[model samples]
Target: MELEVRNLSVSRGGVPVLEGLSFRLAPGRALILRGPNGIGKTTLLRTVAGLQPPLSGEVGLDREAMAYAAHADGIKATLTVAENLSFWAQVFGTGDITPAIDGFALDELRNRPAGGLSAGQKRRLGLARLLVTGRPVWVLDEPTVSLDVDAVAMFGAAVRRHLATGGMALIATHIDLGLDEAEVMDVGPFKAKPPKVEDFDEVFL
Candidate 1:
């Protein structure tokens, strides 16, 4: 499977953020999207995931081949950890959430409400959604933001396993994912040099 973008351009608040940006990724490879804060890394991923519309671009994905988990928790506070995974799995037409619950080492928290979990626990629950969804292209925004050292390692290992299984991922993060074959894409220079206040009405939909 391959994901292709051509002459991609995005503008928020009437100011262009990304212009003429393009890239392609295939199965079994992980692409690390590295950049300083606010260089449109998340915006790029969001566009690919159809979470936002690009000003002008083409995000040609085998639609069924992708799933996205952004910086947001993506977990329902009132639901139990297991309930969250079950909800995602069912939504994606996957068989069950049990396997993902096991994969993310979330067995112990399965019975606990998501709101009661720690930051790391919540992130894991969000990551677990990817496994249960069974999609090939993972568009992740800061998948390891709040994890401790061990949790970070666990997240890295899980991502590695996904790559081994022919799944591709595009991750936007400030930390190294510890994947040997990871291709690093420097998005630093591509960012708008200085952060500017943009109007919400024109920035996002």
Candidate 2:
């Protein structure tokens, strides 16, 4: 099923950041979110991922249909590369970590402990988790943070593959991922206005 976001309003730290935002992501398509720093891109992604509630509107997809990858690697430091993928594979009930290992070039480091890997390696492992998820929609926030040029290309390819398989992606990143078919959305127009002084006074009245 396609992912639909209807007139969504999201907040950060209990203060509104964006409002009246709507978008739809069809199967085999990708949408990229753009805005200056602190523009609530992360907040909006979190809301759509069901990590946090939106102030208003609705995210049409359920948590099980989407996989979220944020800045943190989200790997178990004690687990080996293969083990980490296996764990997520089990959690998502999608057997076989082979594709994930091969997708991010993790075969060479499969036996290595996550704690000992370099930052870029760790990021690759984290991104690999998305493959094992078997979810239709990927909600990623700065997914290429620690990736090098080659690693970035690997990620771009993986995203393309996902889309080709009828999966969708909602990504927030400044880097050019080289996905020419992806649509871009700027959050500037949806920035929430500050509450009027009288609105605050009404709270205590």
Candidate 3:
């Protein structure tokens, strides 16, 4: 199934940020969102992921088909790396954590508590959760924040593998992931204009 966003308008803190944005991501494809920081990339991603409602337009997709990963690791501090993957696996009913453990190179850290891991290791463990999601579309925001060069390459490889299996990715990142085939959308053109005084006056009228 494809993911479609048509004439989507989104806001942050009740103020509009993007308007009239549209795109379609087919199976096995990737779309990278680009713009200046604070340009509402996160808001757009969240809206698409159904984490927040859009001010207008439509995000057409089954909520179950998309898996979202933000800057936060989303791991349980008290659980071991392996346990964390297993938990998400169970949540998604995928029931297998081996690939995720190996994909992110978390094998050695599997038995260690998540809270004890270094920043990069924690990030890896967090990302590994995506593999177990079994969802077709990945909605990621700054996925490489705490990763090193090698780890970034690992992530790039994982994404390629996912696409190879007909999975799609919607990512917002500044650095290149070596995904030459992926399309980039610069959201600068969609920046929302401030509402005029009369527009606000209509609210109370």
Residue 14, candidate 2: Cα error in Å is: 1.2
- The C-alpha RMSD in Å for every predicted model, in order, reads 4.5, 1.3, 1.6
lDDT of all the models against the reference? 0.83, 0.95, 0.93
**Tens digit per residue, CA lDDT, model 2, 51-108:** 9999999999898798999999689989999999999999999989999999999999
Lowest-sum lDDT 10-residue window in model 3: 196-205
Model 1 over residues 38-139: C-alpha lDDT tens digits? 778878888888877778878888456779998886788999998888888889899688778877899999999999999888988898889988898999
Segments in model 1 whose C-alpha atoms lie over 4 Å from true places: 192-205
| Better by TM-score, candidate 3 or 2 | 2
What's the true lDDT of residue 24 in model 1? 80
Candidate 2 residue-wise lDDT at 99: 96
In terms of lDDT, the poorest run of 10 residues in model 2 is 195-204
How many clashing residue pairs appear in each of the predictions shown? 2, 0, 0
User: Candidate 1 overall Cα lDDT vs. reference?
Assistant: 0.83
Q: Which residue pairs of candidate 3 clash? A: none
Which residues of candidate 2, in runs, are more than 4 Å off?
Answer: 199-205
TM-score of each: 0.89, 0.96, 0.96
lDDT of 1 at 59: 86
Instruction: State the lDDT at 38 in candidate 1.
Output: 71
